[model samples]
Target: TKSLSSNFIKNIVVEDLASGKVKEIVTRFPPEPNGYLHIGHAKSICLNFELADEFKGRTNLRFDDTNPVKEDVEYVESIKQDVAWLGFEWDGLFFASDYFGEMYDRAVLLIRKGLAYVDDQTPDQIRETRGTLTSPGQDSPHRNRSVDENLDLFARMKAGEFSDGEKVLRAKIDMASPNVNLRDPIIYRVLHAHHHNTGDAWCIYPMYTYAHPLEDAIEGVTHSICTLEFEDQRPFYDWVVRECEMPATPRQYEFARLNLTNTVMSKRKLKLLVDENVVDGWDDPRMPTISGLRRKGYTPDSIRAFCREIGVTRSFGIVDERMLEHFIREDLKLKALRTMAVVQPLKVVITNYPEGQTEWLDAENNSENPDMGHRQIPFSREIYIEQDDFMDNPPPKYFRLFPGNEVRLKHAYFIKCEEVVKDADGNVIELRCTYDPETKSGSGFTGRKVKGTIHWVDASNAVPAKFRLYEPLITEEAEEEGQSFLDHINPNSLQVLDGFVEPAMKEANGGDKFQFFRHGYFNVDPKDSTSDAPVFNRIVSLKSSFEV
Candidate 1:
């Protein structure tokens, strides 16, 4: 229940409240349900909902489903789930299609007032005539159609008497204006496709540029927040509400959209990644989509905290991806259960210990948070340690399991490597070691000290697990001029390993997260994990050099 930090958008709301320019502020998170919501959308979601909540105002969750070609019920439901998972409940749920009737009435009013007309020009022709930044646009030949004729054609177009793309209704704004968006923008178009919400109720649909403003007005939205790319369209947004004489006028504000280093933020590009199987699906942990992050073990609190730390601003820049990783590590450090998992196991035999002997050693669940209590771990004659922990011939300052070197087994006793056992291929397959009973962890023994401490699981009770290590999904630098973003797809983004964890973790349910001692934080994959065999996705490494 933390309050949002101050930002430009918050400042605007404060001034509006003090001056009584608005009685009660109303905000909304309106997403076009064309694809899955990504991390970039999380920033907007937190902004609108948290801002409204902080002000004791109401926020609505609305869908701008104007284009039936791309929108679907699946995207709508997924959006709702993402919002809820992020810890917000909207005051009202609505869709733009809910006001199609009123939108048609507004369009008719535009035509009647000589502010709009039906154009027979093709989409390509309209685009060519829109003009450049320094050049003035040419007026359409059909711009001066009679109001009665325009209304009649529009009605007929809605009645399905005309084919798709045959004609469109455009606002009669200044064609010679410097802002190209005001140069007679299309407000309505003929789309014969069936809508997911409205079914076949109407053949004609309003354009997003037109529907967005009216939807805001209809919902009594005091401030329409959007990304910086829509700054130019603000002029048209205001013009529509003013010229159409909407009872409620909503003002639009623009803020910088999120851009992350080594990742593409475009939904179009993400959809392509999904369609082409570049990823397993939208929920692939390597993806930046909200579902992907959730499946990868990111907590809602971490994401919300991250969004707040970034703050809101009009300036644009790419955030270092490490900053995000830093937040997750901070969020999970004290909360995740501390345990040992050998991702690449190398068998170590305590050569002098009695055979068939297993001792349960005490280990702290979370040393930083003692309230989490402690658990017992099995230590036995045969154990599995990381294969990387041992070396036949190590360099100077090498502290781990080299022959004749001593190291402490975490929560157990100090052990010295006596011999190395290798396969015929000359690969070290196992190690023979000796443990000193006097050097057991927490035994208050000052006999000696070792420079290294490594974690291991008793081979007798070790549960087989699958550990997935992840790297950046996009390996190359940000896209260069004329290069496709897909060209940078990291071939080694995911490295799966067959490993073993403590027996206590066998019953860990899906979504349960843990810290694998020095390995890192990991989560049970909700989609692929089963009760019998658990699969862990490495959420992040135990430590990072990334500073705030």
Candidate 2:
């Protein structure tokens, strides 16, 4: 395993160990089972798992499944797959719901100590009284109920005596606290909704903020790392742990979340896309979800390298999406097999070549790495070149195929276009070319040279395939908090084309990657492709101007 670079979190772990304030380090990747994990979550997963791993400490994969309304077993399984795919093995697998019994006891302890009380206010009334940044919140009407009454009400609320949102348990902290989260934040809410984990075992669920610190404490987590939005909630986090009298005190550290330009990082927005059928599903190649990236042919190594390169910082910034493209290109350049595939085929007839015969031409798998060796590609009297490779009306510097223009066929002989066959509408449909035997590739023929060398596949033995090209699903950026994200949807995000690969490509299994000549690196579509009909998803282009 590669050594992780020193960052602020790593530095803190080092200091904590050296100072003897902590014996052994423990971190947790706590994701709520609401939706499929996104690329942004990848950052956190790397941070938590790798940080503890670097110091030979423990890390846990915990699902904070408090809100039953959005939690699902599907999300839980997807998260487990994503974490494992990222190359992490958690020391412990846990769920916040696993500690529901203990959490309920803690809430009772708070009530008996007069630190928490059951508030019989509506969610709207609580929000209305939750004063602005410049003001202080008003006290709940039931905040001063006798401890005996609160204990009874809280027990009844747990026993299913209350309807959803009819009553909530709130900490009796200062209502005028400058930090809004410390202003008597709700600890428990009566929700009769069925939970994916607990099922009907719980009619009252603890809010995430209230359960998060407790879960960390119960698991002996030394550092509770989270996004910067929780920076304000740190006070309340400590309050719950301290007031609940937990044995272990876990400190929360906030880091800036990843924000990519021209992409939606929010899970809620991503779910909306899936719900509205804007894309295929959670694993649509165009999506920012980790599964989507995986299905789009991204290697785990590339993503991990990217997360490391971005580093751990508390400063907010928007990363250019091209930077992500750059890493995938780097990862696949020498490794991916460079092969010939015509995405948009235009048939060509070799008039002077022998008919009813096929020639296998030698081609290197990767020019940058000779150890990858070479493969023989079929060439014949009839071949398919890209439609864009030929031009009926050529521009001034156009060096590709045209009437009377000779261009070298990649790995084959030099061919000159002699005629362009057209249909009734005058649209060029085919080309008739003549090849010079003396100019056969690797034949030591230096008598002639062509400015253009274009890739082609033998039509007689071509492997039919489907290609899916993807762009950012969101074309522009807007405030997603208010549903303006829909305004930036990119209509041209996905383009599907029927293509043809070399005959040998027909044997490629799903998830196999290849660098098609003149096309981008593509992955065999794992979900839709079959042995007879392969589908390729373009992962990234061959090159980009973006640099590290």
Candidate 3:
């Protein structure tokens, strides 16, 4: 795991610890259990956990599952898995539901203190009276309810006396407050839904804005860090904690959330895609969810390193997506086994080579990593090469195979194309070539030279496999006017093709990563791949124009 990068948060943490302001640092990764955690969340995960670890502190993995209507246990479990997969061990496992009783008591105390009341206004009415940025909000008629009356109504609301949306518990803050968030925001709402955790124990559920602060303070989180969108809500967060008379006070801090090009970070939109089956599921290789990135062959090391390099800042900008791809390549460069895979195969028959004999040729596993050692590849009379590596009519600088063209076979002898075997309709199906055994690889022969070297799989012992090539699910980084995000979905986001790999890959287990000779880095599919027919997802291509 990479060390947490220095940022404003780290500096604040350092100052707090040095001045004896905080004896022990405590942080929390609070995720709403509504959908799968995405790469955007990964940034926050790294920040919270690594920050606490750096100071010899503790971080809690907290589920902010206040909205039962949208939250689920599946999401809660997924979040836990994603955090652990990212290499973090939470010091405490908590849920907002754990403090539901305390939150209700706090609301009751607010009612007794005349700091909160039950607002009977409809949802639309409340929204309308909340006024826009340029205007002051109008006060509700019930805003002046006596503390005794509010207590009775709130108790009834909690006892299921009212249907959903009949009455809402609103803080009796400023009605004409310039900061609209403080304009008597609703602290609790009546929602008649079964909670995944609590399960219909109460009809009145506390709003996230109210429950979040109390939860942080209850757990003694020294610094309440959150994304910038919540920055404006910081005052309200403070108001809740202070008015509730929590024993501990936690300061709120905000940093910019992650935004990446050609990626969607919103959970609402991600859940929509899953519901509509636009992709396979939340873990589809194309989605930006942490599980999706995992299924797509991205290593935690690469992701953690990427998060560290990005740094924590309040600046808002879209990070180049290529920068992410660059880190994955660096992470897997010398580690992944380099092998040969013929994605679109063309049969090549060595006419002059021995007919029924196969020989084991030594092939370097990784040219750049000598410690990886070498593996023997089978060579025989027939092999399968990529269909794109040949052309009937050569371009000006085409150095690959063509009629009568000589090219070196990787880790083998030189071969000259003697004849092209095609179907009646003029589709080139096969090539008849003759190998020059004198130019065998590792022979140190310098008599002849060839500009092109191509990788091939032995036809007799090749493993039949499928390769899935992926592209950005979103075609356009920015949605144009008059189009929804769905309209910008790429039509060709995923393409599957039959391929052949060396016999050694026949036993390749799911999640195993390898670098195909000239194709790209690929990961075996964990869910669908079997020994009979292995499936590989192309992680990335061999060459890229992106640089760190």
Candidate 4:
């Protein structure tokens, strides 16, 4: 975490400390272990960890595993890895299941105080009776159960005497209240599924609305922060703490969640994409999950800096995705190694050069940073250039290779096209060029200059590699009123090309990143690269029109 910036949350914390309302700050990030964490979760993680760090306080990582039907140990482990990869450590690790016994006792206390009762209505009946926004809900016939009867029924419900959904405990709040959340909300239900944390110890589970507030209060949290979608639940959150007579009172605050253009942040939709095989997996490079971004070559420093730049606010807005690409390019400009790669190979034969001969040329690893030093590249009689760099019929002001044009090779002598070889289909397959030895690069011969300079690889020592280019997974246009988001999936999102790169890159390992001379920054694919051959995934383009 870096220094605290000027934001609404920081201002509240500052005032709290100045007025002696809070002696020490304690915050937490509570995530349900049902699916992988997405980029939206990254904002909450940064806000919680950095805010506590700024005040010399502590933060906890807690799993609100209230629903066991969808929870798994696999998701739990992935969440832990994502947080550590983001460069932060939790002071304490906890789970909602850790307080199951205490939560049960609190529910019993509610029954004894006549604040709750056991309702025998089915799930459908309960929802139907819950009135609309403009009307008041009717009271349940079983709302007046005696304290003794309610306790006995609740105990039997927890003891596995009843089937799932046969009985439920509900708080006896006013159904006529304007807020629908206070309309006698369900607190506990019978679920016969085995929990990932407590196993068969629990047959009935508490609802998330009931478990969340108790978890925060029991942990002695000073500030409970969440997204704006949960703003409506804050009233019930406070009601639980007050009615249960918890020793600590934790206040809840809501901030706007992160939304990015051309990306869906919903975990349900992302899980569907993984389950339906629409993507490779949760870690697919095109997905917006943290693991996906990590596999795509985003660094921790860049993500943290972006979160800091966005800041915390109460208003909702969508951020353009190009802004994120801008930060990564800035972070890597001086760090990534600069090299040459010909992704679309066009064969070229230097007729005037010596046959079966090669020479080594010196090139800087990264011209922007001098301390990286220079590297050696082999130049031979046969070379490969970009297929797009040649033209059969030259257009006006075209600077690349043509019938009578001369162009300088990146680090070698100037070459002029003399002959073009065509195949049966009239497609130019090869070019025969002659080099002027006096006009070699790095020499003092500045007699003339060519308008075009292209990068190439020596054919004798080139390494075959696979290059993957990507576009936006979702289309730029907004969806129509009645169309599904899946209808807008781009069919041409990924394009794979067989290419050749410098021999020095043959030994590059997974997670290594580099910048191709005219291409973009790329990462060695960790999932598919081997020592004999390498696969590169383009991180982002070399330039963008986005400002700040």
Q: Rate the local accuracy (lDDT) of all candidates.
A: 0.92, 0.92, 0.93, 0.90
User: What does candidate 1's lDDT look like per residue over 330-410, in tens digits?
Assistant: 999889999999999999999988899888899999989999999999888999999989989999998998999999999
TM-score of 3: 0.98
**Of the candidates shown, which would achieve the greatest lDDT relative to the real structure?**
3
- Tell me the TM-score of each prediction against the true structure: 0.98, 0.97, 0.98, 0.97
Evaluate model 4: give its TM-score.
0.97
Per-residue lDDT of 499 in model 3: 83
- The digit string of per-residue lDDT tens for model 4 on 235-259 reads 9999999999999998898999999
lDDT of candidate 2 over 318-378, digit per residue (tens): 9888878888888898899999999999999999999898878899999999999999988
**Lowest lDDT 10-residue stretch of candidate 1:** 1-10
TM-score of 2: 0.97
- The root-mean-square deviation over C-alpha atoms between each candidate and the true structure, in angstroms, is 1.4, 1.7, 1.4, 1.8
Clashing pairs in 1: none
Candidate 2 at 330: error in angstroms? Answer: 1.0
- Clashes per candidate (backbone, < 3 Å): 0, 0, 0, 0
Alpha-carbon shift of residue 387 in model 2 (angstroms): 1.3
The reply for model 1, stretches above 4 Å from the true place, is 1-6
Report lDDT (Cα) of residue 258, candidate 4: 93
Which of the predicted structures, 2 or 3, would earn the higher TM-score when compared with the native?
Answer: 3
The TM-score of predicted model 1 comes to 0.98
Ranking by lDDT: 3, 2, 1, 4
